[model samples]
Target: MRMIFIGPPGSGKGTQAQLLSQRLGLLHFATGDILRDAVAKDTPEGQRAKPFMTGGQLVPDIIVNDIVNARLRSKNRPVKFIMDGYPRTLAQANSFDAVLKEQGLDLDAVVFLNVGDEEIVRRNGARWTCINPECKATYNTLTRPPLTPGRCDLCQHLLYQREDDDPATIRRRLQYFHEQAAGILDHYARQGRLIEVPGRGDIEAIYASIVKALGK
Candidate 1:
C-alpha cells in the first residue's frame, strides 16, 4: 500500500513508519532522514535545506518535491511505499498527487497518528539517540532508558539528546505540525482517504490500532 503518515514531530510517526514498513513490506520513506543524510554528506539538496531547517521552517516545496520524485523514479524501487514527514502543505499534496499521476500510482490512504500535545511534549522532550554511526540506538529519558544513562547498551556508544528534541524546539515543531497539517489532513478527509489511529499506549497496542485502522 502507498501510505502517508501525518503527525506532529513527537508523535512517533518515524517509529511507526519504520515498524509498519517492516510489517507491511512497504518501503519506508522518511523525508527528514533523507535530508539529514544529505546534509551530513554535504549534498546539493542539503545545502539548500540547511538554512530552512536552522530556522525551523519547512524547506521550499520545489526542492523537496524534486527529491521525492527522484526517489520514486528509481529503478527497482518498491512499488508500495510509506511516506513520513512530507507534504506538509496543500500545495505539496497537490504536487505529490501530480507526480503519482504521472507514474500511474496514488496514495492508498493517509494515517494520522492522533496524539495530544501533552503526550507529544513528554515523548519528544525526553528522547535521545546514539551519536555513533555504527549503532544508532534510540532511547528516552523518561519512558525507555539505556542500561546506563547517556550510553547505548548495544555498542556502548554515547547517547546524546538531539537539539530538536529539546522542550522548546519540540513545542515549536508541534505548533508547526498542527498549522501545516490542518489543510493536508482536511484535504485527504474530504476525499475519504484519511484514517486516524490513536497514538497512545505500548508499541504493540499502537501497532494494532494502526493495523485495524488501515483495515489490514
Candidate 2:
C-alpha cells in the first residue's frame, strides 16, 4: 500500500492522505511535519534546515533528500507508507527513486488530486486559523465554519486568515505548483504509476474515490 499523494496546496491531498493512511494502517510521511520535527529536535539536518525555514525559503533539495534518505535508512523505517508534501520537484523525485531502490522498495502508486485553480483559491480564501499558539485550530468557512464567526471554537480566540491563504498568495502558489508538478506528474505517468482523482467535493467522497482508484 505504499503510495505518494501529489497535488497543489489547498487541494486536500493532505486530508486524503491522512484518511487513507489510517484506513490502510500505513504510516503517513508528511514532509512538512517531518521537517518541523527535525527543526524542533535541532539535529544536524534540522540545524541546516532551520535558516531556510525561518527565512520563508524552500529548503534545498540536498538537505531534504538527506533527511528523507536518513529516515528510509533508519532501523525503524516505515515499510508501507503514504508520502505527502514530498518530492515536490523533479530532482527530489529522482533522489527518492534512488533511495527507494537502495531500500529495495517499490512505489505502488502516485495519486494525483486534481482540482481547479479557481476552486482552490475559493477554498483557501475561506480558511481561517486560531491565533493562539497552543490552539492553532483551522476552519474553512465554506466547509467547516466555526460555531461563532471569527472565533476559535476551542479557545475562543480570534481567528485570522493566514497570509498564505490570501487569494493573491494562493494564485502565486498555484503557479509555482503547476510549474513544478508537470515534471513529477509526467515522470510518474510515464512509469504507469500515476492515478488521477478529483479533489473537489466532500472529504469522505474524495477519500472513497482515492481508495477505489487504488483498488482497495
Candidate 3:
C-alpha cells in the first residue's frame, strides 16, 4: 500500500513506518533522513539547504520538493511506499499530490498516529543520541538503554542529549505541529482515507491495529 504516517516527533511513527514498510514490502520515505543525507553530502541542493538547516530554520519548499522529487525517481523505487515526516502543511500536500499525479501514482492511505502532547514531550525529553559524527544511534532513557550508560554500544561513542529535545523546543515543535498538520489530517479525513490509530501501546499491538486498519 502507498501510505503516509503522521505524528508528532517521538510518537514512534518512525518505528511504525519502518516496520510497516518491511511488513508490506513498501519503500520507506523519511524526509528528515533524506534532508540530513543531502546536507552531509553537500550536493548543490544540499549547499542551498545547509545554512537554513544549521540555523534551525525550515528549508524552503522548493529545495525540499526538489529533493523529494529526485528520491522518488530513483530506480528500484517500490510500487508502494510508506512516507513519514513529510507534507506537514496543506501546501506541501498539494505539491506532493501534484508530483504523484505526474508520476501516475496515488496515495492509498494516511495513517494518523494519535498520541497526547504530554506523552510526546516525555518521550522526546527522555531520548538520547550518539554524539559521534560517524554514529548516531538513538535510545530512550526509559524504554531502551545501552549496556553502558551514556555510551553507544556499537561505537563506544558518547551519547548526548539533543538541544532540540529540551522542553522549549518540544513545545515549539508541538505548536507548529498542530498549526500545520491538523488541517491536513482533516483534509484526508474528508476523503474517507484517514485512519486514526492510538500510538500509546506496545509495538506489536500497534502494528496489529495497523494491519486491521489496512485490512491486509
Candidate 4:
C-alpha cells in the first residue's frame, strides 16, 4: 500500500511511519532525510536546494518536488512506499499527484494524526536528547526520564533539550501546521483517501489504530 503520514511536529508521525514501514515492508520516504541526503550528495536538485537551506529559508516547492519525483522514478525503490513530511502544501500535493500519475502509481491513503496544540506543546517540551554523537539516546522528562537526571543512560553524556523543542517553538510549529495543512487535508478528504488516526495514548496503541484503519 502506498500511503502518506501527516501531522504537526511531536505528533508521533515519524515514529509511526518508521514502525508502519517495517511492519508492512514499505519504503519509508522521509522528506527531511531525503533533502539532507540530496544536499550531501550534491545532486542537481540538491545543489539548487542548498542556497535556500543555507539561508535558513524553506526550499522552494519546485526543488522539493523534483527531488521527490526523482526518488519515485528510481528503479530500485520499493513499489509500495510510505511518505512522511512531503507535500506540506496544497501545491505540493497537486504536484505529487502528477508525479504519481507519470510513474503509474496511486496513493492509497493519507493518514492524518489528530493531535491538539496543548498536547503538542506538552509532548515536545519534555523531550531531551543525548549529546554523544554515536549514542544518541532520547529521554522524555514526563514519560521516559533517564535514570540519572540530565544524563544519558547509555553514554552518560549530558542530555539537553533542543531549542526547537521548547514549548514556544512547538506552539509556533503547530500554528504553522494549522495554516498549511488545511487545504492538503481537504484534497485527500475529497478523494476519499484520508484516514484520521487518534494521536493520543501509547505509541503501540496509536500504531494499532493505524493498522486497523489500513485493514492490515
Candidate 5:
C-alpha cells in the first residue's frame, strides 16, 4: 500500500497521512521529519545538510534523494509506507521511481490534496509557531489559537508567525507548488495512479474522501 501524499502547505494532508497510516498500519515517512532527525543525529548527510538548513536554503536534490533512498532500503523499513512532503520537483519524482524500482517497490497511489490558493493563503495567515527550539508546537491564529496570545500553551514558550506563512510568501510558495506539481501529477496520472481529493471543510470529511479514492 505504498502511497505518496501531495499538497500545498496548510492543506492538512499531513494530518490525514498520520490518520491513514495509523488506520492501515503503514509506515508514515514524512521527509521533513526524516531530514530533521538526520540533522539531529548529526550523521554525515546531516552534517552536509546543516549549512544549507542554517542558511535557510533548500537542500540539494542529490542529498535529499540519498537520505530518502537510505531510509527506504533500511532493514527497519515497513513493507508499506505513506510518503509525505517529498518529491517536490519532477526531477525528484523521476529519481524516486528509480529508487523504488531498485528496491523492487512500486507506488500504489499518488494522492493529491486539492486546496484552492485563496484558502491556502487564508489558512496560512492564521498560522503561528513556538519560538523555542525545544518546543515547536504550531497554532493557528483563527482556528486554533493558543490559550494565551503569542505563547505556547504546552510549554509557555513565546509563539510567532513564521515568515514563510506571511501572505506574500504563501503566494510565492503556492505558485511554485502548482508549477512543479503539474508535471509530477501528470507523471502519476499517466500511470493511472493519481487520486485527487478535495481538501476543504472538515478534516475528517477530507480524509473520508481520501479513503474512498484509494478504495481502502
Candidate 6:
C-alpha cells in the first residue's frame, strides 16, 4: 500500500491522503505536517526550516531531503505509507528514489489529482484558517464551513484567509505547481506507476476513484 498523492494546491490531496491512509491502515506521511511537528519540537531541521516557512518561501530541497531520508532510516520507519506532499519537485523525486532504494522500498503508485485552475482558485478563495497557531483549523466556505462564521469551531479564534489563497497568488502558485508537476508526473508515468484521478467531485467519489485505480 505504499503510494504517493500529488496534486495542485486546493485539490484536496491532503484530505484524500488522510482518508486513504486511514482506510488502508497505512502511515500518512505528510511533509507539511511533519515539518510543523519538527518546528513545534524545535529540532535542528526545524531551526533551518523555520525562517523559510515564516517568510513564505519554499524550504531548500537539501533540507527537505535530509529530513525525509532520516525518517526513512528511523527505527520506527513505516512499512506501509501514503506520501501526501513530499517529492514536490523533480529533484526531490530523484532524491526520494535513492532513499527508497536504500530502504528496500518501492512505491506502488503515484496518484495525481487533476483539478482545473479555475476550480482551484474558487476552492482556495473560500478557505479560511484559525488565527490560533496551536489550532490552525481550516475551513472552506463551500465545502466545510465553520459552525460560526469567521470563527474557528475548535478554538473560536478569528479566521482569516491566507495571503497565498488570494486569486492572483493562487494562479501564480498553480503555475509553479504545473511547471514542477509536469516532470514528476512524467517520471512516474514512464515507470508505469502514475494514476490520474479527477479531483473536482465529492471527496468520497474521488477517493473511490483512486482506490479503483489502485485495484485495492
**Residue 68 in candidate 2, Cα distance off native in Å:** 0.4
TM-score comparison, 4 vs 6, better candidate: 4
The local distance difference test score of each candidate is 0.85, 0.94, 0.85, 0.91, 0.89, 0.91
Candidate 4 C-alpha lDDT tens digits along 1-216: 999899888898999999999999998999888998999999999999999898989998999999998988888755799999989999899999999988889889999999989988888889999989898799999989999999999989999878888787788888889999999999999999999998989999999999999888
The C-alpha local distance difference test score for the whole of candidate 6 amounts to 0.91
User: How many clashes show up per model?
Assistant: 0, 0, 0, 0, 0, 0
RMSD of each: 5.5, 3.8, 5.1, 3.6, 4.6, 5.0
Q: Which has the greatest lDDT?
A: 2
Worst 10 residues of 3 by lDDT: 70-79
Give per-residue CA lDDT, model 1, range 116-198, as digits (tens).
99898888777889999987889988978898998898989899878887888888878878888999999999989999988
Point out the worst 10-residue segment of candidate 5 by lDDT: 70-79
**True-vs-predicted CA distance for residue 80, candidate 2, Å:** 0.6
TM per candidate comes to 0.75, 0.85, 0.77, 0.85, 0.82, 0.81
After TM-score superposition, the amount by which residue 11's alpha carbon in candidate 2 deviates from its true location, in angstroms, is 0.9
- Model 5, 1-216: lDDT tens digits are 999999987788889999999999888988888888899999888888888888989888888898898887889866699989888888889889998999899789999999999999888888899998988999998889899998999999998878988889889988988998899999999999999998978978898899999998
Of the two candidates 2 and 6, the one with more favorable TM-score, higher being better, is 2
Instruction: At residue 57, give the lDDT of candidate 6.
Output: 90
Give the least accurate 10-residue stretch of model 1, judged by summed lDDT: 70-79
TM-score of 6: 0.81
lDDT of 2 at 160: 94
Model 4 alpha-carbon drift over 4 Å, by segment: 128-141, 144-162
Q: lDDT tens string, model 2, 1-216?
A: 789899888898887888888889999999999999999999999999999999999999999999999999999999999999889999999999999999999999999999999999998899999999999999999889999999999999999989989899999989999999999999999999999998867999998898889998
Model 5 regions lying over 4 Å from their true place: 126-165
Predictions ranked by TM-score, top down? 4, 2, 5, 6, 3, 1
Name the lDDT value of residue 134 in candidate 2.
99
